[model samples]
Target: MGKSIFISLPVTDLKVSVAFYEALGFRNNPRFTDETAACMVWSEAISFMLLTHDKWRSFTTRPIPPSTSSEVMLALSCDSREAVDAMSQAAAAHGGTVDINPVEDHGFMYTRDLADPDGHDLAAMWMDVSPMPARS
Candidate 1:
């Protein structure tokens, strides 16, 4: 298995994207963050590479999709419902838009989705482990 997962995303404005992720409580990993790209670490095993449009283009010859036409959504899990709400609120305060309605509290789980400054779909979710059925 891989040691970690690095999800690379193209951002129209690197600075704005950095701020957007920061608002969601992600810390910048200096080891991988610089002028060309900002590394947003969600966990020890998960990291998001926010690449400038030009820098991202270098990885592929195909044209990048416009933010409006893209439909990719990145879902991240939180420890509790309050964390989910906190992330959504932070996103809005940092200029990111709430793309979905507030937490759909299903008792065992809660979910909310938001769009970053560059229109990247991001979802914050919380799950109650105690309520889940036991695995056989």
Candidate 2:
């Protein structure tokens, strides 16, 4: 069986969050989506399950983090350095903050950080794995 990951996130505004993810290249799967939740596919193997605050609370009583608090930073691979930059720009235009962390560039890799409207941190990156230099 092929393995896949579904990262579940609690969102304050479902519609806006859906648009934010869509701009970053995720397509909503209406088959698994409704007013309370959305299944955003980033790849065949990677998807995000965005749930409304009430829907999230039904799953757990744990408190949701405030906009400034973060427990994780998700990373996404890009087709090229330019793709990474483009994603960052899209993020900024769609109610996200770009460069939450400083951009990084190695000879064979590039990355830029971003935060969604609800302050979820994500890093867009591209790497030439075959051309990567060995650590000395």
- Most TM-score-accurate candidate: 2
Question: What local lDDT does model 1 show for residue 100?
Answer: 60
Give the alpha carbon lDDT tens digit for every residue of 25-91 in model 1.
Answer: 8999999888999999999899999999889989987777766655677889998888888998999
Backbone steric clashes in candidate 1, count: 0
Count clashes in each candidate, considering only residues at least 3 apart in sequence or on different chains.
Answer: 0, 0
Tell me how far the alpha carbon of residue 99 in candidate 2 is from the true structure, in angstroms, after superposition. 0.4
**Which ranges in model 1 have alpha carbons more than 4 Å from their true place?**
101-103
Most lDDT-accurate candidate? 2
Clashing residue pairs, candidate 1?
Answer: none
lDDT of each: 0.86, 0.94
How well does model 2 score by local distance difference test?
A: 0.94
TM-score of each: 0.90, 0.94
